[model samples]
Target chain A: MCGALNPDELTLLSRHTRQIEHPSGEELVGESTRVEAYDNLMRGVVKLSKTLEDGRQQIVGLQFAPDLVGRLYAGESPMTAEAASDVEVCRVPRATLERLIERNPALRKRLMDQSLRELDEARDWMVTLGRKTAAEKVASLLLLIASHLDPEAAGERRIFDLPMSRLDMADYLGLTIETVSRQFSRLKKDGIITITANRHIEVLSLAKLQARCG
Target chain B: MCGALNPDELTLLSRHTRQIEHPSGEELVGESTRVEAYDNLMRGVVKLSKTLEDGRQQIVGLQFAPDLVGRLYAGESPMTAEAASDVEVCRVPRATLERLIERNPALRKRLMDQSLRELDEARDWMVTLGRKTAAEKVASLLLLIASHLDPEAAGERRIFDLPMSRLDMADYLGLTIETVSRQFSRLKKDGIITITANRHIEVLSLAKLQARCG
Candidate 1:
């Protein structure tokens, strides 16, 4: 979030872009699909996941607005990516992106910066996966969702909507759906959040959420 | 491993690098320490870890030779990096690296490619953390370490040494030390691997390991 590209940079980025949309439940990248084109998330959420032969599955990552999808220069995708919600993404062919990178030094630099930032996020998630408790996991996910929902409200304490379903949350956090529901109930009972209809969540105390995260 | 920068490209990668070596058990980037530099593992291995106030610890990652250690330009390190063994690293000052990027576009592209590769590895680890059993986790860790240890061994089945300790491996895999040890024993009993010592593990059945990974 710190090293965002300026208008000129954004214009340079737009040179390699094409738009495509995926409805909810659509697969963005399929199993055994060759990595033909990469995408930059323009709207909605996508989940990168894999399924086992026995039918168990795990959500590897959540790609949000402005997040880059697919391998930059790789020839194939190893996992499947599905639209967790309705998604609109800017598709950039690998060859075209390579040409753009080769032609524009500033564009290449910006991409380097973005890649480094994504690596930092990956390392942060490592902490989440390795150390955090189930309660902390849910808390961290909520906080993350809140921060992304409204960047303006990120610095200050404020509530935000959870865009994904409880099942999605369960898979993403490596917990059962029942555990996710129980955690939600616990949070609501503790006055950390208020749940309303249509899966709306109102964070009551960001401080309390942070405490639970720890 | 195939498309990564060559030795000559690696030489051109010099951008204000500082060489440092830490003996076993020394902490490099502890929690609360300012992450002023991005480190590349020139030799040996480092363990990235974190501990809660309650004394429970988790090992998030193991930085091996030729792996990049820190997130470039990160304002803070989310976990502590300690010497898993005696380790040698090339540390680059963040601002200096920025200046170098401004001057050299080709080098920036190379680094971006490196970061993207790391991002893929992290996502793979996310799946391991989310879905894999302890036995599968150890098996996956072995496969990863094998690839890093011997790129030439690709397309051929071979075993390799695990650089990290059982405790370190357990922490990284999000399992208790005893659990990790038990998984190793199970694998050994199943003829998946031959444990010569606590540190030396040789893969006896690569196909079995892969199947176990699934």
Candidate 2:
């Protein structure tokens, strides 16, 4: 959306926008609170999650660089947005962004495009959460993280750092931490991935990982 | 979006739009096919689903009246869209709708708003599918259907028809037909809902139903 803005619009945006950084594990937006700003993530990752009444948490979605971080035109945030890693975002006041969207068709279209893409991705994740097995769930999460962390090397053998912890991964995949760990060990035993450290993962065989995702 | 359109834009839409009715079981869009037209559901219900390589199907979403049926600006549909019941939709060529969106900011914002709302709903459903039990899942589906079918009577005691069959409900809820049937019977026995027939459901106690949707 920012790419399509004209000089005047860019100037207007700069007037209201501020760059803010958050450390890992910081809550960026609280659930059910009024949305005060529209954030454009410029660096690092964030997780959108909801907590059940009994305290069970589920990571509903993840946002990467260039993704919008808050709901626009809505009164309150539906889920909590947490910094999965050290994060930087361009924060624009909700009212200012709404006014800008009203005046700029290009920006509005860009936002619509982003929302549609997010909706598609969310639905795809629903399939994994609802139907995929525990091992497949772990593989799906790994595949998702790999594609997001290194888009250019999606189908190729590569090594990457995990932005979130194993507990977060287990929550996102809707499995127990032990189950997730077991799956990771099984994958390692089968030579699909190598755990360099707790957070670093080496993809030994992308083909095998993809097959396990099924 | 349609409600905010100007007279000239409405005329332009009317010029190219065609209304079509589909039977209960017709597929509106196949998974991964190029989207040729943008559809607005005028009546009845639609289900968006994805199928796995092993032939397991999971319904990711349900669309009601005035909801957009296909994605805009995307090349291919991510999931298969099928009519959950007798449906009516206003179909416009994809190119035509794209051009109109470019010309109208309100329409773009409306679509963006819709997409964001759908994303929120999808995330909420993810929590249900991932963590909720079988009886809770059935209760959740019933509550969802009742609210959509009659929004004004959501919290009040009311009755509404189920748009889809037991199999469709099972697919959407990520449970077997037997489990879904057993849950329905349990709900009836518990006096949370009264089964008028196989497809008809009378929500006798909205509070009890909500409690069951733990």
Q: CA lDDT, every prediction?
A: 0.75, 0.87
List runs of model 2 lying over 4 Å from the truth. A154-156, B154-156
Native-referenced TM-scores of chain A, all candidate models: 0.85, 0.96
Specify the highest-lDDT model's number: 2
Off by over 4 Å in 1: A1-17, A154-157, B1-18, B150-160
Say which docking band candidate 1 falls in.
Answer: medium
Query: Interface-residue RMSD per candidate?
Result: 2.2, 0.9
**lDDT tens digits, residue span A39-148, model 2:** 89999989999988888788999988888899877898999999998999999999888888778766776777788888888899889988899999999999888887
The per-prediction tally of clashing pairs is: 0, 0
Which RMSD values do the candidates have, in order? 4.0, 1.8
Compute the lDDT for candidate 2: 0.87
Q: Give per-residue CA lDDT, model 1, range A65-155, as digits (tens).
A: 7777776777778678888889998887777667666766655656676666666676677677777788999999998888788668644
